[model samples]
Target: MNAWICNSSDGSLISFYLMGMPFLPKSLFLPVFFIFLILYLFVITGNSLILVAVVIDSNLLKPMYFFLTNLLVLDILFTTTTIPRMLSYFLLGDQILSFPACFLQMYLFHGLSCGEAFILVVMAYDRYEAICHPLHYTVRMTPQVNIKLAAGAWLAALLIPIPAVVQSSQMAFGTMTQVVNFFCDHLAVVQASCSDSTFQTFLGFCCAMTVSFLPLLLVVLSYAHILVSILKINSKEGRSKAFSICTSHLLVVGTYYTSIIVAYVAYRADLPVDFHIMGNVVFAILTPVANPLIYTLRNKDVKAVISKFMSHWSRGYP
Candidate 1:
């Protein structure tokens, strides 16, 4: 009768539903979740140690490390906002997120990312001053000037994502509410909307390019000038010493920019879901984890400070 027909229609809808299926197989969930959890803890602890070391050591209180401290803090903030929620989804097999929660996560994740990009540009400029104009480094990078630059970077990062968020908020959702990835990524969420997404797509593209490419260009130009200055030094030992100081910075910048460019290209081409997720995880999590190790291993002063701090902590605990 009528009841039988209604039950049949419900069964058909469930069979055809695309949004609710698990993207990852059950067998792979627990192992991947644990690995990501361990990586997240390492990122948090390592970056926090760097920030603490910079704050306490009097000798490390220069403008260069000041910028680095801010960068480390941003990395911590960046990873914290995205990774925990992703871990939760992996552990619980639950991907249901309310509308506001998803939007907030997207805004904060991209906002911190933009802030990190701005901070990297500032760090490159700090290196440029220290290497190319050694005599004026102290004068140009004074504490007050550093404060102003840091404030400007934070403000710029926060404002750049406003247009995209506003545009996304206007889109209407039809039958789809499930996002493919673990957390609510802004691009994926926007793509799910039923309304006209042309303007949103264009705005997101422009913002991503502006935030990623512009800082990358600045970093390259600063290092070009830095290399030219380093070559002018007469002694081989002196040139090696100078290059060592900047090598860590260069490695971090290279990893960050390369991963970001790959991700952008993949996103534009409509690549597979797994590819997109992997690219973002590399840029967001792996880059931050690598920053502390690169700086500590490559810089003698940082290593000494870290050793001293660890020894003090060990003695106090014992």
Candidate 2:
């Protein structure tokens, strides 16, 4: 019993040390680090401004904008959780994270990601109501209903990853391995486990399928129906306006889902590390940065609000 206890304690210490070590190549570090730093700054500033504008502009206070605000908030949380720490590893060379810290990062990262997926679904449904059931838009998408939907999305995201986290924490780490990726990704971390991970793999697969693929299918279906509805409208002006509203959403959703699917496929197929990294960079860095820009540039309401805000600031004494 005493020998067993000592071995267990030694194993814990080794796991702690492995979790804390930094792993990155010097040649590839600086460029990737700087690029992501710029992206992180842009994502935070852009999303924050969008959230503020949504709150201040009463005209923007509808179901669509409300859901958008939630999405902006989630994007901010998601990028901040992963990118800053990753940048620190490059800038300061402080690659070590405690087990708890790594787990925390993974939790927040996946939680918000999953939440954003559901939020996108909610947004699609909002658009559906507005386009298909125009008369019931107001009645169907009440403030209470919107709040519940947002809350449910968040709750589902948080709950879905609990099993994975628990299983991951319990896995034994036999001395020498380190996480190759910049962040503690679910699959990467699970692959390093010394215990039997069959159940963990299955659980993660289930979560990924439900959280990622199902929502993607819904998004595709929603856009398909939206397109059909737009085509039926007789007025050229009406069709043009409706298409414009959806264009931003389509671009953002397309970038997000495509990158995610590519990353998962590459990881599953054991592709080269560079390919996997590129996939993650697209999903993690580019998508969040692009989301605000896509909406602001393509959606007139956001552009108008931003222009008005900028004009107000420009004319001020500061």
Query: Model 2, residue 256: displacement in angstroms?
Result: 1.1
lDDT of 1 by residue, 1-318 (tens): 011122221211211111322456778878988988998998898888888888889999998888889888888888988788768767885565665667777888889889988998999999999999999999999999999999999999988887788668666663334455566567766766655667787778788888888998999999999999999999999999989888888888887787787777666677767777666666668678888988788878778888899999989952
TM-score of each: 0.90, 0.90
For candidate 1, the TM-score is 0.90
**lDDT by candidate, in order shown:** 0.77, 0.77
lDDT of 1: 0.77
Q: Which residue ranges in model 1 land beyond 4 Å of their true spot?
A: 1-22, 268-271
lDDT of 2 by residue, 59-122 (tens): 9999989999888888898888888877887777765666777677778878888998999898
Considering only N, C-alpha and C atoms within 3 Å, which residue pairs clash in candidate 1?
none
- Evaluated at residue 87, the lDDT of candidate 2 is 84
